[model samples]
Target: MRRLFRLLTIYAVFARYRLDELLPDHAASGIVKFFIRLHPAAWTASTQVHPWGRLRLALEQLGPVFIKFGQLLSTRHDLLPEEAIGDLANLQDNVPPFGEQAAFDIIEAELKGTTEALFGHLERTPLASASVAQVHAGSLKDGREIVVKVIRPGIETLVQRDLALLLTGARWLQKIVPETKRFHPVQVVTDYRHILLGELDLGQEAANGAQFRRNFADSPVLYVPEVHWNLSTNKVLTMERVYGVPVSDTQSMLAAGVSLEHLSELGVEIFFTQVFRDNFFHADMHPGNVMVSLKDPQNPQYLSLDCAIVGSLSKQERFLLARQLMALLDKDYEQIAILMVEAGWVPQSTRIHEFQNALRTVLEPVLERPLNEIEFGPILIRLFQTARRFEMQALPQFMLLEKTLIHVEGLGRQLYPELDIWEIGRPLLEQWLRDQIGPGAIMQTIKRNGPALIEQIPHIPKLAWDALQEMRKLSENQQKLLQQVEQGHLKQLRRDRIITLLGLIGLGAGLSWGFNPHWSLSWSEIPLGAWVISALGASLILTRLRSNPDD
Candidate 1:
């Protein structure tokens, strides 16, 4: 019943926005059109809001999840209409805060103390509020400025409720619309479920921030705020407050003497570095989660926030992805197809030539376009679509990385429209690839794992003995299974011989009756049973022979 209410609410929002116009006239049935026409909001929608603008407004009104969905769609500038993407880009996450008292109560509960007891100063008002958490300014007893992030009260229940609705809708679409299978709506929702749930755990976010800080320690490109572990819990997180110009405020950055051209290049460099060099990245890098430091105006630095949804790829994936990108740079569609099959992204049975041609058809046009006119986000999306034809399963991490890259590249292009991402990123990726196969990387890997390797050396003999025992046990099990199979085959052969003998007897009796009609077993007296037995035996022998054609 609650789900029904939510569904109706969603429909009402759509009707209110007159979003049906976004769909084609042939998309809906006459009954749905009639009902839509009868709806009051359909006619009464505010005139000020344009047809495309209503999409963003309706999502905003629906709730945070919907707003975030719009934000995600906003990244796909190539796939979606420019006007729609423009409207969605304006979907701010300035959700109303839960009361100060609720925020304080959550902090107290998580920290096992009152807010006054825990901090020298705790603000009653929140500094900023978002979909999942709210931030409050405070000072520690040691005079350190910090911000307290508290998870919204009962957000888990809301997330679960909405996720159920989303999954239901996805399943409904898949059932009603067969073409939707290519989109993998259910898997997308499941990936989203992990991300949303992960955000609810403030401790994980704190850890991610700490790791990011460590990764960029003594570096000049990016800065991650220090996480105050003593004051943090799964529900409450405390970190050093950072102040800087938001990355989106281009005017402020420019006025502050920050080089937009260099800044744009740095954004691409940072993304590739995080993906290939560090192997860990802040996945949700919308402008809201990033800031620019004016202190280094000549060489500006990025301040990252909201590290809850970080992403990483396996060692092999990192290598393959880099190689694939390099292949794209070289316009080697054959290599791309081969790498895809080797990586198990596509079926091993996929025709290499056909796959290469399909990719070439999709990618050649974009590649032929001018460098500055190209968009990487939409190209990757189109590649995924093309891969769907060969039954390639989409990787969740790859998709996240794509979205983050899109955010970074899109923002970079916005900051400097002439930002050539391919031009900037190609050299960095090549350097990283060289590093991977270099001696320095091998030595570094050994040094990093030295302690663990030494510890395992002591157990080598025992480990080897145990492995041998396990293999012996597996061999015994296999031998027993083979014996059982052989016994069954022997039993079948014996039955076949019996059937053949019975068939010969029946055939001989039938022949005698046919040749000597006056005999006791006369042709007229011979029952249907004799003929059936003869046919059954002959069929068994023929089937057995066919099964073993070599015989």
Candidate 2:
């Protein structure tokens, strides 16, 4: 009954927002028409509401789960319209907290102790709250200030229940809707399910945070909070509490004399460093999870939180992604098309000319804008959408990267509206690409594996001899197989010849019986067996000629 009510409320919100306008024009009649009519504002273009606006409003009304999904969807500019993406970007994840008592209960249960034993002082009120969890300010028994994050009571059950509902809707949409299969709604839900479930495990998030801290340990641009493992569990987390201005608090940052330009550019640098240098990145980089330090406003470093979602790519994916980005920056659609095929993103059989043309068609307009005016994230997303038309399969790893890129760029633009992202990112990417293939990399590889290489050097001669022996045996087997095939061919040829000779003799006899004057046999006197022989003989002769045209 709860699920049914929630589902009905979602439909009501959809109708209230006139989201059904997103349906195809053909759907305005028939069984779909009744549902379409449920929308209060349908066909009211004078209302000054765009489809994207309605979508954003509807998601916001649907609750935190839907809002988060919208936030994820907003990042994929390649998959949605500009207006829609823009509207969804405004979706916020803030939701009302369940209850302070419930949070305390969860922490007590997870820690196997009363709050008084674990902390010298535990705040009855939460410091922050979101859909999945809430955080409380507390002081350890040892006098260190920390924050205790407790998973919302019964959140697992709620998330699973809502996810099942989402999957049902996705299945229904795919069945009844047209042109939506490309979005792969069901697959989106499945992927979200995995990520959400992973986020539910505080242990995994602690590991991610710890790894991120190590990756940026020596760096001056970003700060990752330290996780208190001794006090952490699967459903509870205790971490060092750092005070800084929220990255979204630009006015406060400006008041503190923070250099917005440097901060914006540093965001780009940090992103590239994490991806190319460390190969591990915090995927959920929304403004809510980021903070700007006040210690050095001139050389501002970012503080990141909520490490539940992180991402990395395979070596091949990193290479291809870098090359593709460079190609796009250069406006070399042809190179991008070639790379797509080479990277196996598109089928090898995809026509290069057509693919190139398609890429240029999608990218030309985006590239025509000024370097500072163009959005790097959206263009990259648009490339994915265009590639889809050429039957390019979705790369799940890239999805995380793409989402992170959108967050980084969006936050950067907020800090400095005129920021040239390409200018900031291009040099870093180029340098990384060069370092990957340069002589220095080779020297480093050899130096790292010097011992293994030296140990294998002694076996080189024996390995070469074994390879030669194997090749020799393979060659001999190949020759024997070819000989057998030729012998079989000759035997088949001889058999065919015999069959043709017998067929010809039968044909000749049939002709003599029917037409030859010496045989004195008319057509009426001819035996049916003779006709059958003649037909069979003709078929055999044709078959032999077709098989060996040289004959």
Question: Quick one: how many clashes does candidate 2 have?
Answer: 0
Q: Over the stretch 1-551, how does candidate 2's per-residue lDDT look in tens digits?
A: 98888877876776677665666665522455567565564544333688888788788777667776787777665466677778898887678887888888888888889999888888989898888888999888888889988888888887787888989988887887756776778888888777888888999999999999999896789988889988899999999988898898999999989989889999999999899888998898987899988998787889999999988988778888899889988889889999989987778999999999998988899899999999877687778778877766566668789889888998999999998988988999999899889999899888999999899999999999999999999999999999999999999899889878977887887666567666766677877877887887887777878888888
Model 2 clashing residue pairs (backbone): none
Candidate that would win on TM-score: 2
Off-target runs (Cα >4 Å) in candidate 1 are 20-40, 43-53, 73-87, 341-351, 368-375, 381-393, 441-551
Q: RMSD per prediction, one decimal?
A: 5.3, 4.0
Tens-digit lDDT string for candidate 1 (81-102):
6578679979977888999888
Cα deviation of 248, candidate 2, in Å: 2.9
List pairs with backbone clashes in candidate 1: none
Q: What's model 1's lDDT at 486?
A: 100
Kindly provide the TM-score of model 2 when superposed on the true structure, using C-alpha atoms. 0.85
